[model samples]
Target: MGCQCSKFWVCCWDSEQKGLVVEPPSVENEENSEADDLPAFHEYTIDQLRMATSGFAAENIVSEHGEKAPNVVYKGKLENQRRIAVKRFNKSAWPDARQFLEEARSVGQLRNHRLANLLGCCSEGDERLLVAEFMPNDTLAKHLFHWETQPMKWAMRLRVALYLAQALEYCTSKGRALYHDLNAYRIVFDDDGDPRLSCFGMMKNSRDGKSYSTNLAFTPPEYLRTGRVTPESVMYSFGTLLLDLLSGKHIPPSHALDLIRDRNIQMLTDSCLEGQFSSDDGTELVRLASRCLQYEPRERPNPKSLVAALIPLQKETEVPSHVLMGMPQSGATLPLSPLGEACLRMDLTAIHEILEKLGYKDDEGATTELSFQMWTNQMQETLNSKKKGDVAFRHKDFRAAIECYTQFIDVGTMVSPTVFARRSLCYLMSDMPQEALNDAVQAQVISPIWHIASYLQAVALSALGRENESEVTLKEGSVLEEKKNKTA
Candidate 1:
């Protein structure tokens, strides 16, 4: 019987013989010995995988189908405190041990920033596990399909398209162009809020040399007929992803290509992108998607061409992925100057004495008791405005953030240096350097010793062409930071 799987992908299963079967190596796989020269990967033990996974505890399981599936994924932390996602495959997935190691070694040799890096593999006894860098934030499917708070913005969706293309370009450049079953669930957001394609998806099941994503419907039209995946098939899957991004919903690749040919781009575009992108941008993207979904595999654009096309569509350089995705920055703290940290831990008792002795007045001598009816009423309003500002800030609506923060600051019911710093940042983003500097100075005045305020002042001054003052302010901030660290 002929095996449809290419050697670059994986071995095909001999169901009648009840074992994995291998076809002759392709020209690509014949040269796969190059992986031998690559850096060595850790051959983790079954015991180690068990320990990291808390003996395969139920809570650690991350796979949607649980243990009933042929493969299960678990989230765990290594002894070195590095987090990881472990995929444990069924015994029947790979009947031969060396073939399993060879496949693992080849995949483990792959390294790219856009890839959810494969760290190690365990193939001891009946246990087979693959470990990858853990993504704290969830998958693209969650952000796009089942968005909770807000849908991904147009800029972000465009960025995701570019990022996915770059990832595929990198893999193809590295001679690992056989990335299978590419889809939304295969892309996970990392700790830095960047989307990365999971490398585990690159590993073939060995059962059939087939795509591993549970939803095989995402496969290209040719793959269904040929039962083989090529680089061109991956591009077809990529077109489906483009449709997912544009429409904010899954559309069959066949249907999507028809929509493209009919020039029904408006129906293909998500309503959320109503005013976000120009018609030219939409038309260009639709054209690209159509090219990717060409009926003939040879007609589709390669990964490099896709990358070239997407480079022009990207906007908002240096903006973090999470910001545009409308999700919280993953565990990243606000960038605070040394003074900001000091203010956060400032001795309230000492501050109170310093204020009384140094003639600092609270809200023009209005008592600081929150229980008072007058103060309580003002406090409620202040809290509400600050909350609104935070929501706006998370949404990257900087102009609205400034307005809400300004309202909170104007009330003066509470003394929050952070509020002033936030407004200063919004001002900077809105290209109002003078207002930014004013807010930064006000923040410093409110919390006399905060380093972030001085740092922000340096930024504002530099932006305003006051180089000399900016340098001085920067040095002052450095000194404050040094003092705080020494005190700590």
Candidate 2:
């Protein structure tokens, strides 16, 4: 395989023999050449990363453990208006900058729907950041064991198992099979409510002095004998994940196997999943898990075989997200904000600055339990006010729309960039430039990447006769709009 100067052959697997075989994917990847046409991995500057993640704010951290852990991950958004997860490695993780770049590139090249798609990397001096698509829905662990509402449905669990196995299958096919730190926490729900293996797992290669966190009880049997992990070890981990899916708890692999041996599948299954799966479904999955947890690593089935075993049990491709968690589909009842519709017109950088000035960032960092509770309590009511504002604004009644949006904002706990932007537009129409500017800034503070917020600010500035400032705002909005369009 080659990419101009980055010419290096990948170590492919012998699918027929299940052995190591060195084969260049250059020829084989010809049909899939579009994969290579993905956006180039940019070497982001540290400042860009800092702004994207709100300077690594404590609230941005999404990892289950240790903020001061050797490596930490934060959720952020790009100037391009993309939601991203930024993994920041401590200086000691890779003392050598060149080595870090090589490893980052190696892992970043592997892309698939089943895995988090790596967008780019940042290697400036000691700071190393790997940016990948952010999953809005939480991990399998949260959905299964520690759900906020209720446990995952049986259909969703079956789908998660199959999707994860297939993700592993895709990685193995790409000739990068040694996935580290594989667990339920590593499998996240994507935008479509599908399970996706985190691309961060790909970084778990044979690097020296690197150790991953996992419960000691679930260590793969082969790794106990040898310090190294082979492809089969990954299958063993996948088995653990299957157990997590079925049991909804971290059961020791040995204990789980014992329970399976007794055919106590009922004891092994999650009580929440009771009456959802048939005996045949339970048996098929348990049998597959048993094979995966084989003591002899060589006897363990490969990822491809695991995919085959799980596919037969797969559910419908597009299950509603609300159904998975026993929630109802409520989007139509509550509009997603007109600002979301005018997203392509805002200045992203100016919005970020507005947020930074207002002591807020994005959801992961800026939002808190109290704020969320307030939103949850008054969401429908807030929608009613915004809806009234929308109706008035549509009828060219700027005064009425401003009064409606003001009431929604005066609640002080509710957040809606659209309400702020709409109010600012009304203020401008009423020849109230100062009020328009204040509301425009508030809109940006709540939703930093929204383009329309900045556009409104520019209109307000020009009305106030701040020509130079208005020109700068217009240029920033133009740049943000161009980026949005290109990505679109």
Candidate 3:
């Protein structure tokens, strides 16, 4: 193993493992070679992660279990427009800093198509976080239990099981055999709609001893007696997962076994999967699940054997997962609104007209009320800077506008969403999308309901090639504008 230690944290990777370590493995990743590859591990600072998640804003949180869960997960986008999922552990969760780093780095070495690979981690002061590939479609629980659109098809369920088994096999091959709390929630669908086992389940939270959150009757018998987890425990959990897929519910292991022994496949099988598979296929799956849930830990099927058993059961093998799940293909770009279209086409003149029409009306109430008695020379300088920025902006001198706007913002004499919006457009015109995004975000912070701020943000995001985010932001702007028009 190759180790890279910094003052904040330690990152290690297996030198022998070949392939570039890209999080959210892409289809084109198959062509990666040993010669042109970067290390699979990164050590991210807490600040970087905070910026990505917008200071851990409430809206960014995506953890299904919600506040009740020990750790919180947030959806974030990196500066490069790469989406990421960041898991922030409770302060006391990882009491041993060294242990947290070791576990994170060890897990970071793994990169597999079947896994939501760990990209990096942050261990600063009392904070401990793990960053991984963001899976857009959400967890198996949502689709399997709380689905709104349609029930998960039989082919997709079989694929999930097979892919999970493959993930376990891959992790075992890499000498990371133990996975904690392997449940439906641990399985998330990626942008391609393919099921991937979450890598976060691989590392045990040192401070949290009660690993299994489910009822003791459902937990592996060995775990109840020993208060420890083993590879067999993971197999037992996998059996529960299979039961979940089969029944579309959280049935206790003993109860499921009884139902299976009574030859009541009808009772155990999901109602929605009635006409999907043959009797033989159902029997084979039940038999596999029974073996996995064997009373004797030694009798459980290993991940390799499990994968072998599941391989033949996979149906519609050639179909893309997105099609099977009835989701848009990863390559499909969402249709943009008029504002988003203008932004994509870089129609600065059109954007300028919109800004001019909107004016600084949104900033009127937000600007600091400075009376003549309290006004200082510093305030005058700030106002002069803003005046200069507006003039340069009107003349299309983006560079000069950015400079003057920076001075005005630095003074911090007053808050103006309009000024920030103008500066954001100036940055976009100057071909600095990231800076433009930051300024636009700041404008929104100053005036939360300002439609112009959201519109500017959409343009900046589009320039950054974050089309999905841009579409959402542009739609938000349109909504705010409509609401304002109605109220007016």
Candidate 4:
């Protein structure tokens, strides 16, 4: 039997066995050498995953497209206080559980600083989920396209392109060459605000081959006919990303190429990025993008080539990503409002006083609450439970307060955001941050604009070691409080 051989592996005929034989590949590679240094990949039980995601709550959703997306991505915190991004596949996504595990574990073996590496996966019955390190800063699409404070700087854009190219190169070297739906949304920024390629795109979504979520015209031309993605197709998508960084818009590759051909660099560039980069630098990026957008997939530059081309184009290499993006650093302390200060200090006395002052004033406008006029036994029991919980909370008896509040909530006789908020604080005092966070979210659901609920959530999130989410929630609470004061 004739057999083939490669640099990594060998196949040969075994005369003794009278059959072809394949030998395991050599493990003498640097990537394999660093395996022990990487975080251990976990096989999470469905229960653990559910608890992490608060039973797949809607508020935890962090995907760009929300629930309408094919596979919804959620933000969650593990019992270990580590934040994670969970991608839950639809029921129809992975009918073959074994195949799903194989793919997830294969991707999990890969660890890179430029990628949001997969930490674990859960596949039990109809449920399928992938857990990865959570990125605190928002996605590239939000910063580049729908920016609120300021558009992404030219230096940051260059860094993003280079980092993403390096991510692709690393994945290719690890034998995972194809990436699906490589777009700005697929790029997320970490706590340091540095861009990283999402690892989720590396897994082949078995859902009927509709991979590209962008305009059909912008999709790789070959995918239109084949209904499949190849490594070169990934390059084509990268070209589109380059165009996006240039224009700060979703320009179809064909149109972008036409603009490049016409020497309309000025017109193609983002208005916000004006005066940032020299025309020479812009021309060089445009030239590279044009090659990646070539009609023939074979002509497209490989990931290594893309990395080589992008490395020289990088700017502000010495400046940290968070500083360049004007985002608050991990150690940076924001001025805290009175409520935030109390929460930070865990001054239960101050928090209790503040809640007492708030005193159901926001309750009068609550439309979700059941009418309190009913004299049924259930209503009386609900009121009595809340009264007892309040007394326990006042006395700092958090355990009893939690129990009483649970009874009141489970009875479903009335909707009291105040009761939920009190229970949340009690849970915080009880050292049950996850349950506290859940109750705080439930409070927000009952009263959408209540600042106290947001404040409690911030405290719970902080206890859970999710500082980024905590800061955002704290800011939201301050805003809502200000709005309420103005209305008052």
Of 1 and 4, which scores higher on TM-score?
4
| Tens-digit lDDT string for candidate 4 (1-488) | 01112210111112112221232232222454433444689999988877666677676788755445768898876655467899988888888889899989999988888889899899999989999999978899999988888889999999999889888888888899989889999999998898999999988665565577666888898999898899999999999999999899988787777765555555678888867886556655766677688789987778776666666778889999998888988556556678878986768679978887776777775535467554778778877888898888878888999999899889876778888888888888778999998888777666656788878988898888888778777776776777777789
Is candidate 1 or 3 superior in lDDT? 3
Compute each candidate's TM-score over C-alphas. Answer: 0.60, 0.65, 0.79, 0.78
374-415: candidate 1 lDDT, tens digit per residue: 457667788889899877866668899999988987877676
The segments of candidate 1 whose C-alpha lies over 4 angstroms from its true place after superposition are 1-40, 66-69, 212-216, 330-488
lDDT of 2 at 173: 80
- Number of clashing pairs, model 2? 3
Report the C-alpha lDDT of model 2 over 1-488, residue by residue, as the tens digit: 01111110011101223432232232222325434434666678888777666567665688754643567888875544355899887665666778878878887877676778787889887777889888867888888888877788778888888778777777788888988878887888765566788888777522463434677678787787776678888889988988888898899999998875555555677877767776556656666777778898987888777766676687654667556756434222222123332322333334323433432222333332354554574766775787787778766688998888887777776566666766786787688988987787666656655556666767677777776566555544554555556677
- Each model's C-alpha lDDT? 0.70, 0.68, 0.79, 0.79
Off by over 4 Å in 2: 1-38, 205-211, 317-322, 325-488
The residue pairs that clash in candidate 1, if any, are 339-450, 339-451
**Candidate 3 deviant stretches above 4 angstroms:** 1-39, 65-67, 356-408, 411-419, 430-488
Best by TM-score: 3
